[model samples]
Target: MARDPFATADLEIVGQVTTASNVTLVCGADGVRVVYKPVRGERPLWDFPDGTLAGREVASYLVSDALGWGLIPETILRDGPVGPGMVQRWIEQVRQPVGRPELVDLCPVGEIPEGFREVLRALDGGGRPVSLIHADDPRLRRMAVLDVLLNNADRKGGHALDGADGRVYGVDHGICLHTEPKLRTVLWGWAGEPVEDELLSDITLFVKALPGELGDRLAELITDTEIDALETRGRALLDNPVLPLPQGTRPIPWPAF
Candidate 1:
């Protein structure tokens, strides 16, 4: 196989994502734009081990690729201008029309549109009642399934991008693949709904491939126990084959974005 030019090309930092918790740099490498999350810039979380977030991001991409979902962009763990980090191909988002929702959005309470599922009702900053909802699209449905398989702990609305290429891509997966059940997301719109047959079939094959090349690559990034937990989640999904409801107090990430 030919080497990836994006991996070897020099990355020139163009901007910093100030809103991100960790250091996130937007860089350009040989005309290709990518997001660089250096391991050294990762904030120490009590739950996850230090300097492992970048690897987890890459692992999420690998799993997404193996499932043939293409929900995650091209991602790799490589030495960057700062140090070793996660470098992912940046996706250009498709601009939505005024008052239109992309994947997830907020609307007046009890005014959910057709082909949209309401997740929660809450008071906005103005003390007005509003509902959080997501689209009833197949691409987003696949993303929800991918989150289940990755045991993704953070799937904020902003992470699900409506790409210019007319595909939904999930990003910011540094907090996924933990051994513990830490599934947190705003994709509860499909809770209790049956996963599609085709997706279930794809997941079945993914579970079977877990102990082979995919597993080997993940082993280099996450721990053996995490990989085992990931496989267990996949098998469990195949057994149930349903989108699960939110458990515990905090099901969705705060701020929703």
Candidate 2:
């Protein structure tokens, strides 16, 4: 069974890698995998305080839970051998032919794949109601919208998970929360298309409800200014005006779905 962080010689140190952030791995513990962060750090972006990424990771999972989205990695912040770090669900990927990793913010308009489009359709929420989807879904237009409002700069392709039953997941929300538009993702191939009225209303309802359920969490992590801006955007989307959509972010990235 999966267990909490514990001091154990069983945690075999694995090789280091510099893909997203420098991460250390510990393998071969019954149903356990450990990811470690180094104290001697890299050049920090001044906006976010040092050692804040862990908190962001927690917050992202919480938000994903709130939305009832299964696309986020299962994570917990626990006392580790070093200090405090996050323990996420261990993923084992067999050799399967998938598309190349692509960033949603930099996705070319014409390069979106069929699976990406299918996930967007799944994420559309249709004409029924405004509900939450998992943050892990790669074709997460709503998550992307939230990412933009929160200024989540780390919404990478690999970070967006492709689940076991062919669902997408998302992770690594360290750089979220900002007051700027920050809507530069590669998931919007439908920029010229009209925003559907049903989905627009759903965003309206979701934003209106945020103050009740999401407000408390948002208050702690982000500034009041940002919360208000997100509300404003939701309302604007509901109104369906000819406003400038988030540029440079296609709704689907290649190999994303």
Using all chains and alpha carbons, the TM-scores for the candidates as numbered come to 0.97, 0.61
Number of the predicted model whose lDDT against the real structure is largest: 1
Alpha-carbon deviation at 191 in model 2, angstroms? 3.1
Off by over 4 Å in 1: 1-3
Q: What would you estimate as the lDDT of candidate 1?
A: 0.92
- Weakest lDDT window of 10 consecutive positions for candidate 1: 1-10
Tens digit of per-residue lDDT, candidate 2, span 1-257: 64443434244445444554545444433446645443233336677653456655655666556545454667555544455555566554333456443323222334454334312332222453222112323346555544543456555456654555555556666666555555444344344345545445555556767788677876665567756766776566656633244455553333332
Q: Per-residue error at 10 for model 2, in Å?
A: 10
Model 1 vs. true fold: TM: 0.97
Q: Highest TM-score: which candidate?
A: 1
Instruction: Give per-residue CA lDDT, model 1, range 11-116, as digits (tens).
Output: 9999999999999999998888999999999988999973389999999999999999999999998888899999999999999998787789999998998999
